[model samples]
Target chain A: MTEELNARDKEEVRQEESTHPGRSYRPDVDIFETAESLVLRADVPGVDESSVSVRLDDGVLSLEGRVSVQDYENLTPVATEYPIGNYLRRFQLSNDLDPEGIAARVTDGVLEVTFPKSAQAKPRQVQVTAG
Target chain B: MTRFRFASPFDSAGRLLTLQREVERASGNPFDAEQSPSGRGVFPSTNVFRDDDGLTLRMEVPGVSPADISVEARENTLTVSGERTIQIPEGTSYHRRERGAGRFARALQLPRDVDPTNVTATCKNGILTVRVAKSENAKPRQITVQAA
Candidate 1:
């Protein structure tokens, strides 16, 4: 089990290294799973719905886009803390995702991705009959 | 009627010019009337990801249609620009306007090298997603090391 976990972790690191080279800007993402679908919410500041993109291909979910900083250009800088850059993040989706039926939307800088679980992947309530 | 005057020497017009100068000084970019027309009071945001096969970009922009958005890729920069016009209901005064309106433009520097000609974008559910296929040189190639 430990070996498997380590292998998975290594694969994740390799995946991340391959996608984003230097800058690491991982948007905050929350994932919730229901009986029918798995929903993912990502918080991307300074991004409009028109500029974001979400896609899934061959079990790999790729998200790429930029965050516009139009208003910050005029404000006087008091202190700098927030790491500002184009937002880029990736997730290696499991086989449970229904790639064809996945849906996504962005509202108020919040991106919501809904992945309906495959019929076989969903938990089944078995009915027991008298034997 | 008599008016009380402050000690400041500049009039309202002068004060406005001073404020504009201050703003320009604070911001590295000079304030241009042309740029102002393109600029809206909204922030730009984008999401990026990649799987084993391809890369995807999801941008958040509400109240924009596919026809209104324009995406162009030149060299290393990918520009996404559009205008979002929200028509407030008649006779309704907005007490609090949080979401921004008007025109917005955002450009992203893709992390990985891609085939500029093959990039595709789709707008659905108010989210614009641009997918760029990794070029043959950029994609990971497996090295078969034969035992020497």
Candidate 2:
């Protein structure tokens, strides 16, 4: 059962070619919407803070991560189950989300991006006056 | 028996040992192939690397806390077990859920017996690296020759 579960979620890099050389994988992300913001968490193993870049441009959120090649230097693999590569993914954000309010940080190779909803986009209680 | 043991300055036994080590490394140690076979896309995909001195086992375990990970090396087997928990806050709706969360344990049989006391493991940037040194007998030795 564990093997089945793991086999299903293991995502392979698509054939879409990038301008850059080498391989790039689409990171697995969990996106959830809270009352105030939409949170996105992506798994990007082998990348540190300096190598990860998150950008919000023209309502498009882009994530790029580069794995440190020095880690594998001078080491020959006897057996390899996973391919080492960089990570790239993009998402189109809705206008309701404030681009300036987006906050992102990476810890333990997991990148967390929080997009706060615009003030007008949020649900609010309307005051009623007795006529 | 003497001829078999000392066929030449370099005996067949040493060559056989080198060949065996090469085959074991290339084929991922068939002696324990049934245990945690690779290429099936298992969780925390592991890769074994070799150098002159020892072997290095690396596993991708992003988002797993160091406290939750446990690594054990005994004899010629290495066991790595860990738990991954995803905390979903209350009153939240998931738009897309792709990440998996659970506990996983994988055991791998090394090609050669390793020095258990020399094993060292470290988790960095969600990647776990374990270094296992080959035992004294397993490491290649250089013998000195003297004139009679």
Cα RMSDs, all models? 23.9, 12.4
Per-residue lDDT tens digits for candidate 2, residues B1-148, read 4653435524333443343344345544322334554545566677778787788887889888888899886766777888888887799999999888888877777765567668899998889999988789887779998898
- Chain B TM-scores per candidate, in order, are 0.62, 0.70
User: What DockQ does each listed candidate score?
Assistant: 0.02, 0.24
Distance (Å) between predicted and true CA of B119, model 2? Answer: 1.1
How much is A25 displaced in model 2, in angstroms?
A: 0.5
What's model 1's lDDT at A45?
A: 49
The best candidate by lDDT is 2
Tens-digit lDDT track of model 1 for A18-93: 2323232566556666677777766554566687789787778877655443333333332111333445667788
lDDT of 2 at B66: 84
Task: For residue B23, give model 1's deviation from the true position in Å.
Answer: 15
Residue A1 lDDT in model 1?
11
What C-alpha lDDT does candidate 2 achieve relative to the native structure?
0.75
